[model samples]
Each structure stands twice: as structure tokens, then as C-alpha cells.
Target: FVSEAFRVFDSMPEKNLVSWKAMIMGYARNGFCREALKLMYRMEAEGFEVDDYIFATILSTCGDIQLNEADSSATCYLETS
Candidate 1:
């Protein structure tokens, strides 16, 4: 489903904030935290300003992965986004 979701997401002509958030959250919920982080980066690269909810999702995803440097990673994510 995640892969399918990505396929659909990639095919979209003009992605907005909501779609990006859904994809990121879906990846995180499905235990694909790394993918979620990557998507967050991609979302920013595409000029989508991640909102507070998305930030929370990223933090939660980082927590799911038990990242040792969650704070630093989040700082980097925030900076990039």
C-alpha cells in the first residue's frame, strides 16, 4: 500500500501540503520511518513548507526508529523544511 501510495503520489501533477502530510504519516504508520524522513526531505525540496503537524509526525517517526540523535535530526529537518 505504501509503494502504491508513492506511485500515486509521484504521478500527481501538483502535490499540495495535505498529500505530502498523508504520505509521510502513512510511511511512518507502516513502520517505514526512514522512508517517512526521506519523504519529509523531499517535501521540503519541492518547496512545501511542512507545518507543525508534519513536524510532530517527523518527531514521532524518529521516535519509532529510536534514533539516537532525534533532537539533532529534527533540528536538521526543521532547518531544511
Candidate 2:
């Protein structure tokens, strides 16, 4: 579960940009659009410098967040091992 990943993330003594991106992408890819967006804002609040990857990753998920509930349930349930 991504919750497990977050545990590790939370414990990090330091987080670089890639760490933020990985967590954001995990939340996004797991259909947690709001979480990803919130994390993006949190990343900004933490004073990390933004790059093209940040914009691209968050921008790519705009449509995901806009989906109606029905469409979201049907379209965004990705299974993982």
C-alpha cells in the first residue's frame, strides 16, 4: 500500500525533489488525485524548488481530479502487485 510508502517518506531525515515527485506520482497513479494535489501544495510550502517535472506531473493529473464521481470510480481503479 502507498500508506506504507508514506511511512517511509515521513521518516526521511531529508527529502529531495525526486522523493516528492515519487510520492506525488504514487498518489496520482493510485487515483488519489486530491492527495497528490495536496502534497504538491505541501511541497511548495516546504520551499522545494520547482522544475518542469513538477508542473508536468501535476498538470497531467488535472483531468483525473475533474472527473465526475462515477467516471472516477470506473476509470481510475488501478490494481497493483
Model 2, 1-81: lDDT tens digits are: 999998998799999898998998888777776676568667877998556675556556646534353244323322210
Q: Which 10-residue window in model 2 sums to the lowest lDDT?
A: 72-81
Task: Estimate TM-scores for all models.
Answer: 0.78, 0.69
Cα RMSD for candidates in order: 2.3, 9.1
Q: What lDDT tens digits, residue by residue, belong to model 1 across residues 13-67?
A: 9998889999999987777777777788789889988778887876766674354
Name the runs in model 2 displaced over 4 angstroms: 65-81
Error of 1 at 79 (Å): 5.5
Q: In order, what lDDT does every prediction score?
A: 0.79, 0.68
Tell how far residue 7 is off in model 1, in angstroms: 0.6
